[model samples]
Structures are given as structure tokens and as C-alpha cells.
Target: MSKSCQGLFVEFVKCLRESDCMKASVEHRSVTECAKVSEECAGLRYTFFRCKHGQIDPRTRIKGNKGY
Candidate 1:
């Protein structure tokens, strides 16, 4: 993981931890179950994805990465 995306990753994890899906997953000892309700954190996920993609994409590098 790149240092630039770490903050986004932390935000995404915090969002996940706040969701009901994650609470239930913790109760059931199943982590993957939270993925079903991931839409709640879609925006953060997309931003993180873009940040990671930008690291390897020449066009994004030239154009400048989208800011959070």
C-alpha cells in the first residue's frame, strides 16, 4: 500500500467498523459478510481505488490525482 492511500484506507476501515454489517460479522466471526453491505462505504472505496490506480497510471500522474 502507498503512503498516500493510507489515510483513505483508514477512513474506509472506520466506515466499515461503524456499519451494522460489520457488527453482525463480528458477532458471527465472519469478516467477509460485511462485503455485502459495502455500498455504505462506496465513495471512500472508490476514492481509495482511484488513489491506488493513479500510482501506476501515467495519464493520472500527468493529469494529477483527484483530491479527497
Candidate 2:
């Protein structure tokens, strides 16, 4: 991931930690919508990336369908 994308993910995690409503609300939005909000809040352009199973969930032994 790019630096800006990493930063946005960090900020999104922080927001999830700070607000109970945010977590619940985010579930209502699609993944793309969530990424758009994160990018806009961080003042960065969004880029879509794919993550294989091990790259995302290390605990998972199976590998497939890990993109968002």
C-alpha cells in the first residue's frame, strides 16, 4: 500500500476506536464508500488494491477472495 493509504487506514481505525456509532454506521456503507470517506477525510486520493489471504489474515491457512 502507498503511504497515504496506510495513513488513511490508520485514521479509519482510530475513528472506529473513538466512536461507537462510526463502526455501526460504516457497516451500512459499501466497502467503496468506506474507502472514499477515508480518502476524503485524509485529503488523499483513493486507490484500490487486492490482498491475498495470507497478506490480510495471517491466521487463515486458505488463500483466496481477500479483496475489498
Best candidate (score: lDDT)? 1
Tens-digit lDDT string for candidate 1 (1-68): 76778899899889888877776665674545564457888888788888999988998777666645
TM-score of 2: 0.29
How many clashing residue pairs appear in each of the predictions shown? 0, 0
Clash list (residue pairs), candidate 1: none
Which residue runs of candidate 2 sit more than 4 Å off their true CA positions? 21-68
lDDT of 2 by residue, 16-64 (tens): 4444344667468654465455533333223223222234555543543
TM-score of 1: 0.70
lDDT of each: 0.76, 0.44
Please report, as a residue range, the 10-residue window in candidate 2 with the lowest summed lDDT: 44-53
Candidate 1: segments with Cα more than 4 A from true spot? 26-33, 62-68
Candidate 1 least-lDDT 10 residues: 28-37
